[model samples]
Target: MDQAITMNKTSFGTATTGKLGMWLFIVMDGLTFGAILIGGLGLRIGAESWPAAGSVLNVPLTAFNTFLLICSSFTMVMALNSIVRGDQKGLVKYLILTIAGGVLFLCVQVWEYSHFIIGSEHLESILKGAGFTGSQFLPTTGIYGSTFYATTMFHGLHVLSGVIYLSIILSMAFKEKFGPDNYDRVEIAGLFWHFIDLVWILVFTVIYLI
Candidate 1:
């Protein structure tokens, strides 16, 4: 009698290895961000008084930056859809637009950091005029600064990493590596990009708005 042979599958549920790996990474990364934000909130609650985020940060400008990120997320989805539909040209265009949006967001964030944290001459004068000492708003002076910079800078680094990731994907895309049969790479990249955007929303609401 011949024995029946069985082949072992190497995927989780319906997801392939790469897709399952990306899902695992996103879950772990989400938890990391959640812990940081929750700890920051805990610090804020424990403190007698926390520096008002709106008073020191440019709310309008950051709000606009948030809009740009949201638009980028849409463009990313369009890019993924384009590739899936066999429109390589559309995919490239939308990917470029997404990269542009990410770059613009980083530029605005750099400007905000420079104006408020690094080059604080103007902010100091404004704080003095407002009857509060300059150091009060400085990141080095309190737990508020510590938590704020820690969380924001960490998110910024993730954004920077995402941009670099997208850039590499764009290069491969331009070389025509992605198509209907091989679009899973693009989808994985999109998953990471979307997670970055989602984390920023949480960060904005928790750190800036509240």
Candidate 2:
């Protein structure tokens, strides 16, 4: 018996659809982040005094956080590979590591927030710490510091939420809910996880490093 099956020039699968949707969200979210980042930069450029991110925030501590996120990305890829290889144990291992990495990253973010104080005090601290003898720094300056705090803190909240979601995904995967035959859900969660990691890369560079 001879049968002929035609393959389409463009074959769209679930992964394609999933990635498309994620990209749409990223585009829209990028616009929002861009506005915030640009506004922060503009205000920073036009300000009398601005706290240098690297100086204020402990780069060593943050570097550890960045490593945590990078490790999570690797763990996510390992999870996907495990699923494709039909190795359930490896899938669980990678997912558990990923979740742990996210948790550790969030903890580092929380620790960073300790350096910040309430309205007037935050400025006082920033000024005093950055070699200011007088009132060189003010919290009311173009709302730059506040906006920076708001945007980055909000992203931290999102990462926390994503970690919770990933934990649930790991729990399900451990129960054998996902395997080689059914791993789209895992991939979808991973897409969001990787997006968080990708977004942090931008945030770290724009907000922290640059």
Candidate 3:
């Protein structure tokens, strides 16, 4: 029984202290997101008339943004794979691509947020030209806007955090610090990045799609 327990623990990928700690953080962070999502759903269900997200949200733009983020997840995977294969150059290349994807995703999200918050004429015209219809969606607008911003901004912050984390890992990669013999740090970072991507999928579905 003891051996079985040990096997199970090792199977979860906590091969290093860093990996174990990251896994713990991921669990706690996941619960926080779960609570937020559940609370938001409750609020929406209780509200008499929830605003239609599609009307206010620039769906096409956000869909593109989502695609961008998903692509980052792929780049992250390739980065890990490259390091595991003892290809430091490939690792660095993929890391740069992943970081670029994250940066671009954040930029697009900021633009979306600004439009909803300021609703300037120039911005309005730009959005309208892009086929956006709804007006300003400030958090003060109603429950819909409040929940929308709260969830997305929270997730955005996570993406920003992930980007910073990946940047640190990238710096280390540039130093050639990780290799097949000692690449747990890179794997740990990949775990976090992938979690961010997965959570965003859930957020997009709950907040934007339904």
Candidate 4:
């Protein structure tokens, strides 16, 4: 009976092993991001003074980028629905739009990073010109700069990874590899993409908007 039960066991829960593994990975990754953000928040709160995000960063531009990511998440949903409904053309269209959004988001991030971190003027000079200076809130603002760059870059890396993953899935989708009969791969990719979007919402709130 034990051997039979073992042989019959296919899932740890309602999810198959692959799905379960993905969920576990998402959970662990979430915890890692949470730890970093919380530590940054603690440092910010404990500090004597921290620069306002608006003064140090381009809030409006980032807000637009955030909008793009939200739109991408919606397109991803449409793509998944298209596959489930066996609308191959619709799936392809939405998947391409989603990838386009991801690419645009990354491009904007690169521009932002370059504007701040890699320009003709040092970040310190730029910050000083923006009215943030001294030890309180310049480029040399110690923990603030460290935490901000660390968190944003880590999230950017995830965005890059998600784009590559979605692009591969999109290629498979163009070949009609997903349909109602077998769309688990599309669903899995959607899950990861949605997670990336959700994490960005948190990062935008904490790091950019406050």
Candidate 5:
């Protein structure tokens, strides 16, 4: 019994130092996101002239982006499962898909920001012709604009970082650095990716739908 307790299962799908550290970091980061989101909610709740949902914001575009992010989470899970089954090619394939999802999400988000901040003539014309009202929102626009960009920009940084992290894991995967006996690093990276996706769900609900 003592010997069993002393055994370190680092290579047999057990939590290692890196995994523990990532979980700790995730907890702290989650708290930080919570504080920012709560602060934004407070401001929004107190604002008497808060803009209605879909007024200035393009809800349809953002909803699509949200769906893309959620799909990325699924791909990340698939990547982990593939590696656990000792399928290197499957791991690489899913990781590439997951990374593509993150990249596309960022691109769409940047386009959305441009529409809100710099004002897109083509998009505005289309919306105006369709009888929809569109307004430009910037950090300097007002409290709503400030909080909106702050929350999203913060979350965007996480997505960008997650993409980079996954890219490194992909590189390692190409070198056959992970197998059924050892894939803790990939699992650690997946935890971070999943956390980012979950946070975006909250951000979408609060900042977009609400």
Candidate 6:
């Protein structure tokens, strides 16, 4: 009986060290994002003219995107919980749902950028090249578009990367590679997922509605 207890799994699938490594990567990423946010705030502060965040960006759409991310976070937790409880089916279900949510949010972002941001930037470049100088590219021309594109797009790329990470994790999950005995892997993924969600909430408040 003593040997049985000793034989219990010591290396949770990928080891605790690997889990901690993933967490460290997340913390470092948070720091990098914090730097970008601070830089933007500083730029705004020093400017004689600052653009408003609510003018050009679509507030309603951003609000929807914010909700989508929040829901995905919940789904991530559900996936982790299911795995720990040995319910592989539930785990796969929630993981797929979370991935779908991320994809939907990304699609919305692409459409928004296409309609308001990417198009504008291309237009600006063309005008500048033609010597038809204009301030349309300037943040103050419309506060919403400028900061919206800057902050959200910055964070959006992070979300895109995160989704890719989650997709890989989910693939392993679907193969029945992780379960109640090996829950650490899902926990690590959960950490990154929640961090992405938190960052988006902050971005929405500071860059879209504020």
Which stretches of candidate 6 lie above 4 Å from their native place? 1-15, 118-150
Q: Candidate 2: RMSD over Cα atoms?
A: 5.0
lDDT of 6 by residue, 1-210 (tens): 344333334443544787789878878988887886777677667756544554445689879988998999999999998886778999999999998888889999888766643346656654455343452543343333355467776778878887898898889988999866666778888888899899888777766665
The lDDT ranking, best first, is 5, 3, 1, 4, 6, 2
* Local lDDT at 99 for model 3: 95
lDDT of each: 0.83, 0.73, 0.85, 0.83, 0.87, 0.74
Candidate 2 Cα errors over 4 Å, as ranges: 1-19, 118-126, 129-144
Residue range 1-210, candidate 2, lDDT tens digits: 011111111232434677678778868877877787778778778877766676555677777898899999999999988886678899999999998998899888776665444334654666677655443323333355565576677678768877888889888987888765567678878888888888888777877787
Clashing pairs in 6: 56-144, 57-144
Q: Decide which is better by lDDT, 4 or 5.
A: 5
Candidate number of the best TM-score: 1
Residues 112-134 of candidate 3 have per-residue lDDT tens digits of 98878877676555445544444
lDDT tens per residue, model 5, 136-160: 4568767877998999999999999
Which one wins by lDDT: 1 or 5?
5
Q: How well does candidate 3 score on lDDT at residue 35?
A: 98
Against the true structure, candidate 3 has what lDDT? 0.85
Candidate 1, position 106, lDDT? 94
Per-residue CA lDDT of model 1 for 1-210, tens digit only, reads 011111112222466688889999999999999999999999989988776667666788989999999999999999999986778999999999999999999999887776665546777765655445663455674677788789988999998999999999999999999876567788889999999999999999998899
TM-score of each: 0.88, 0.79, 0.86, 0.85, 0.87, 0.79
Candidate that scores best on lDDT: 5
Task: Give candidate 4 misplaced runs (Cα > 4 Å).
Answer: 1-13, 120-126, 129-141
Better candidate number, 5 or 6, judged by lDDT? 5
Of 3 and 5, the candidate ahead on TM-score is 5
Range of the 10 consecutive residues with the lowest summed lDDT in candidate 4: 3-12
RMSD of each: 6.0, 5.0, 5.8, 6.1, 4.6, 5.8
**Where does candidate 1 clash, by residue pair?**
none
Question: In candidate 5, which residue pairs get closer than 3 Å at backbone N, Cα or C atoms, i.e. clash?
Answer: none
